[model samples]
Target chain A: MTKRVAIIASNGGLFDAYKVFNIATAAAATDQEVDIFFTFEGLNLIHKEANKQLPMPEGKEHFADGFAKANVPSISELAAIAQEMGVKFIGCQMTMDVMGLEKEDFVDGIEVGGAVTFLEFAKDADVTLTF
Target chain B: MENLKANVILDAKGLACPMPIVKTKKAMNSLEAGQVLEVQATDKGSKADMKAWAESTGHHYLGTIEEGEVLKHYLRKSSKDEASEKKHPNVINNEELEKKMEANENIVIIDVREAAEYAFNHIPNALSIPLGELKERINELNKQVETFVVCRTGNRSDLAAQKLAAHGFANVINVVPGMSGWIGKTTGINK
Candidate 1:
């Protein structure tokens, strides 16, 4: 049976973006249905402009070189792979409203919805996680 | 081992978790079913992760070979016929299998999951014949015995059961919702 995985992404740091995309893409690769909901600061992950400005959290910038050395995909590249793999991306509408952002600010192929919309999908998910 | 050739060779060396799998999935999408893919990776965990990922996706994980620091993982893409979600005509739930075990009924239980998966936990006394090796090892089993086939879920076991039936093994039953839903007695390395 194919399992459904639902993830709530609430952070948008460089490492956090990697964590979200890693889990999302891995689950999608294994034939599992996956949905990622970006809320609060996590919206930056899907924001076309904000995503390009993803900063290494505080003093952890030194690890970026190691990540590059390890051939870790950039945040935008992982996001593109996740999109191609059919991992559904949902941006929180409430967050966008609070941040004065519009749908045009996000990358293509993402659904904008509120908490209830995400809960509808997450309630019956086989695995529900927050990052 | 020297003569084994893959239709495609993916170099994932220096990549960590998810990159290897992500690239493998992309490459697999371009190949025809039954074609083999060889992935070269330096990540130590790729061996087990590749096996688990392939098994769950209905692909054939042909095991891994290590050369120096690089692990070479071979996987055969599943054919459309196999991925059509075919189920064996004869089936039993996990509970029925557990009951039979509790009653001490003489039956053969074959676990078709990868060795790594089986090593974690499996029904006691279940034979570990992975689906990829089932055809070659078919002769080792008695065709007369009542056999129950299982995997992490039921997909691989369904395919294994069909293969057994085709090989003239009668009384073969696929245990649906296999070990994933099994609440029976299990003994393995993790236990």
Candidate 2:
């Protein structure tokens, strides 16, 4: 039984990136279908450069050190891992319009669409996660 | 002492949580139905993980034999009728990985660590493809050759290693202790 997973990536912060990739890859590795919808600030995660500038959350200055020491894949690297695991990536078009960003602003191959498209994926999904 | 033989035997000493289990799962997948996989590990928790993993995957957990500091755990692969177990095999320690890179020609080492870490310190001649960018940028590397992946430790690279294997990279190795314990020459932006 292949489970369907739909993720709403709305935060686009360091924490969110970590969570998003882990969940997406974990599900995909297990043969589960995963779709991630990047909306609002979440769209930043799909950007070429802005995603790297995401600051490790405040009050956790040493958290990144722990990740580094533990060899935790960076957020972008996690994106690659997730994709390779067959997780589909979607960037929200409405969010881009509101933020004045073009399709070229995001990473390659990420489908740019509206919430209607995302909802269609979410409709039959067995699990819906928001980060 | 009788020399031990197994369809697949994994040496996992001095490693921490998740790694032993991860490697064991990977090793088991390479075997055919009913083949035995022996895991010699130092971590105490692997004993439990092994049993739990076998149960979950429908494989038979034969049990563990403890000798001195090492524990040898045996597991029998499930029958063909059983569901397939997920695996990400082919792990390499820092020493073995470094030696292979030193000796072998046309071996590509992709560092999946973050850019900041890559800029600060990275293996000489290793390409930077941080984990987050890996899925999108996998096309950059040639899948035909041996690709050694490294991260801060082995955790991220293990994941990346699995991704590469899944993506049809015939020969993929995850370097343990990553760049943190690498003993070879490294040239980064800071250097």
Candidate 3:
């Protein structure tokens, strides 16, 4: 049976972004339905331009070469794969409003929703996680 | 094992978590059901994770063979017949099962999810019999006992229940929306 996995992403650092996408893609790979709600700094992960500039957390730059050597997929690459795998990406509407952002600022296929909308989906989810 | 052949080979070596699974999922999509996929990965976790992912997705995890630092995981895409959800005739809901447990009913609950999943959280006293190992382990179960089969969802337990019924277990019941919807108490290694 397909299980629903709901994730709340509120961090935009490299590590956090990987965590969110990794879990999302893995869940999706297992034929699980996945929805990721991006709020606060996490909204940058879905931003058309901001996502490309995701940086490793302070003092963790040394891991960049190691990550590249290990052939880790870029954040954008993983996000694209997650999208292709049908992982739903939802940008928090309230955060967008508070930050003076618009739908055009996010990547295509992103659904803008508020907490209520996210909760509606999460309430029925088999697994609810935060990153 | 030497004679086994895969229709497609996916090189996921040097990749980290989610990449192996992501690439495998994409590769599996192109193959016809029942076709085999061999994934080569250097990630230490790929063996167990790949098997759990394949089984949970209705695919058959053939096995993994390690060659030095690389692990080759074999999986067979599930045929249409196995992919489709088939419920057993005898059924019970999670609520009903919880009620039975609360009442201290003398019943056997067999969890058919992977060992990792069961280790994280499972019903107390629920026997761990992963669906892949059910046939060989079926003898461990008493046919006379009233057994309830469960998994993350009803899909796997449904198949397990059918298998139990076919094996002449008369009172096997499948718990629908199994552990995913279970709100009752659970005990596992993670706890």
lDDT tens per residue, model 1, A92-130: 999999999998989999999999999999988999989
Candidate 3 pairs with clashing backbones: none
Estimate, for each residue in A79-121, the C-alpha lDDT of model 3 and write its tens digit.
Answer: 9999999999999999999999999998889999989989999
Query: For every model shown, what is its TM-score relative to the native structure?
Result: 0.66, 0.52, 0.65
| Model 2 lDDT per residue over B1-191, tens place | 32334567788876544456656756776888646678888878778877776765667665577789898887766665432332457878888877887787567999986554565468888898877789999999899988889976577788898998889999998887777577788875425
Question: Quality of candidate 1's docking, in CAPRI categories?
Answer: medium
Per residue, candidate 3 scores C-alpha lDDT tens digits across B1-191 of: 23345678999998888789988988999998656788999999898898789778878775677788998887877767544666689999999999988887667999987654565568988988878789999989999888999986688899999999999999999998888789998886425
Taken over the whole model, the C-alpha lDDT of each candidate is: 0.86, 0.76, 0.86
The number of the candidate with the highest DockQ is: 1
Runs of candidate 3 exceeding 4 Å displacement:
B82-191
DockQ (C-alpha based) per candidate is: 0.58, 0.04, 0.56
Summed over model 2, clashes come to 12
| Candidate order, DockQ descending | 1, 3, 2
| Cα error, candidate 3, residue A104 (Å) | 1.0
User: Where does candidate 3 chain B have its weakest 10-residue lDDT segment?
Assistant: B78-87
